[model samples]
Target chain A: MKSQGGDPDEELVVRVGRGDPAAIQALMARKLPRMLQLARRMLDDAIEAEDVTQELFLRAWKQAPSWQPGVARFDTWLHRVAVNLCYDRLRRRRETLMAEPPEQADLGPAPDRGLQARDTGRRVEAALAALPDRQREAVVLCHYQELSNIDAAALMSVSVEALESLLSRARRALRAALADMRE
Target chain B: MGMMDRTRFEALAEAFGGRIDLWPDAEREAAWRFVAEQGETARALLADAASLDEQLQELRPPQPSAALRQAILDAAPRLRAGRSRLWRWLTGAGLGAGLAAACAAGVLAGAVSTGPSADATADALMAASDDGAALGPVESLGSVDTESNS
Candidate 1:
C-alpha cells in the first residue's frame, strides 16, 4: 500500500531519476546505512547482507527513472525490495539446508558469564537471530527499523492485530532466552 | 480516546515494550493516562518489558563498509544529454554511419546556405559526434530494461 503524502525522499528520488549526481550521493548517504543494517539483522550474515544491499540499489537505480510519487513513498518501496530480497535468500537457505534444524538460541546458563555490554549485545543478537522469520521481521521492522506499526503491518501483509501478536510472542521468547542476563 | 484498562495497558506494554512512545498512536494517550492514575503500578507492569528493551538496545546497528559504499556509488547511473527523437534515430543507426550521414548533411547545407564554411560545419559535427561517443555507455545503461532479468 502507498503512503498518504509528505514523503521526504520524493525530491531526491525525482532527481535521482534524472541522474543527478549530487542527489544520488545524498541518497546513498541517507539510505545505505539503514538498508545495510536492515539486511544484516534480517539475514544475520554480513556477507549476504552486503550482497542484498548491492542488489537493492541496482533495483533502485532502475526504478528511479520510472518512479511515480504518491503511489508509494520511496523509502517504503526500498524497504519492500530489501525485505523481499532477504526472504528470497532465506527461502534458498531453507531449501538447501532442509535436513538441518534452524539454529536455536542458547538459553542455557553460561559458565563464564560476563555481563559486559559486548557479551549482552551478542546474546541479544543471537536471540534475535534464533527467532522465526516472521517474528524476527516484526521485531526488526517495529523495533530496529523504527517503522510505524501500520507501515510494518502493511509491509508484512498482516493485520495490525496479527503484527501485535507476533511482536508479543517475539518479545516473550527473547525475554525468556535472555532471562539469565537480568539476574 | 477510551480509558486504558490494566489488561489493555499490559498487552500494549508486551507488544511495544515499556516505552509509551513506541506504543501505537491511538493507544499512547490512554496509556499515558493510565500511567498518570496508577504511576508505580504501571511502572511495575512495564519493568520486565523495559528490561528486555534495554537488552535489545545493546545490539547496535553496524556501520556499512567503505568498499560496499564505493561499489554502489560507482554503479550509479550517470547524467546524459537529452536524447531527442532525431538523436535517438542517429544513434540507433550505428554511430559511425550516423556521423557520416550527419556530416554529409552538414556539408550540403553549408554549401547551399550563406552560413559558416563547410570545414567549420564539419568541425562542429565532429564535436557533437565526440560528445555522443563519450555518453555511449551511459545511454546504453539507461536503455536497459532491468525488469527482464536478463
Candidate 2:
C-alpha cells in the first residue's frame, strides 16, 4: 500500500488502504461529478442521480479490503454499479408510469452542446433508452462507457454476435429518431 | 437476430468500424464495398447504423466532477477502515476464545486425570509455555525412556 504514485488509480487505492483521509477526499473530488452526471443521465433526476453516485462510491470505499487487480477495473466496476442503479430507477419509473398514466417520464438533464451535438446525443440516448434493457446496456457500455465492443458484449452477458445485433438495432433506432425529424 | 457468418460479420464489422469518424478514405471505402457486397439489406442497415453511430458519437463524455474523483478515493479508505475494524474484532475474539478454550481444556484434563494428574498438568503447561519458543508449539511427551530406546 505504499504510495509509489506510479499508477494514479492504483496509488489512490493504496493510499485509501492506508487510511489516508486525503486520498478519500481526493477521490471524491475527482469522481463525484462524473458519477453524478452518469446517475443523472440514467435516472433523469438530479437528486436520485446524486444519491446513486454517493452510494456507488460508498460501496467502493467499503469494499477496499478485498480489492484486487484483475477482476475488473475499479472505474469499470463503479460505472457498472451506476448503470445497474439507473436501471433500477428506470424500472421504478416504469411502474409509476403504469400506475399513473398521466404522469410524465422525467428524462433527466438534457446535455448542453451544439445543435448537431445536442440533437445527436439526445437521439442516441432516446434510441438507446428505447431498446430492451439488456440491448440498451450493451450499447451504453460500448458507446458511452467507452468499453471495447467485445467487453461491452461480455458485460451484457450475451454473445458478441448478439451484442452486434443489439448495437445494430440501437443504431437503427437512433437514425430513426434523428432522421425522422418529426415532432 | 442470429449472426451472419462469423468471418463475414467480422470483416464487415471491422470495415464498418474503420470509418469511425476519421480514417483513410481508401480503407473506409474498401470497407464500404465489403458491406455493400454483403447485400442491400446489409448496406441499408449499415448506412442507418453508421449514421446513428455518428449521432451517438456526438454524446461526448463530460468532464467528471471534482466530487466524483474524491468519492472514489474516499470510498477505498472507508471500505478498508471498515474491513480493518472487522478484522481487529475477529482476531481479538479469536485470540480470547482460543485462550479461554485452552484454559478450560487444561483445567478439565488436569482435574480429570489418572493417578499422574500433576505430572500431566505440568507437561501441558510446559508445552503451552514453550509454544512460541524455538520448537514452535510442538507438544512434548517428555519420555526420555522412549528416546533412549529409539
Top-TM-score structure, candidate number = 1
Docking class of 2: incorrect
Give candidate 1's whole-model lDDT: 0.79
Q: State the lDDT of candidate 1 residue by residue for B1-150, as single tens digits.
A: 999899999999899998889889889999999999999999998896788899999888888888788778677766544432234445455555448457557745865475467776545545554343223233244442221111
Q: What is the interface RMSD of each candidate, in Å?
A: 6.7, 16.0
The lowest-lDDT stretch of 10 consecutive residues in candidate 2 chain A is A107-116
Model 2 residue A139 CA deviation in Å: 1.6
TM-score of each: 0.77, 0.53
For model 2, residues B1-150, the per-residue Cα lDDT tens digits are 233453654444432332433222224455445555677655654554455456667665555555644444433442221222222233345445455456546654765574366767655544444232222111121211111111
Clashes of 1: 0
Q: Residue B69 CA error for candidate 2 (Å)?
A: 7.4
Which residue pairs show collisions in model 1?
Answer: none
Q: Once superposed on the true structure, which residue ranges of model 2 sit more than 4 Å away at CA? A: A1-8, A25-41, A103-120, A180-183, B1-51, B60-150
Cα-based lDDT for every prediction = 0.79, 0.53
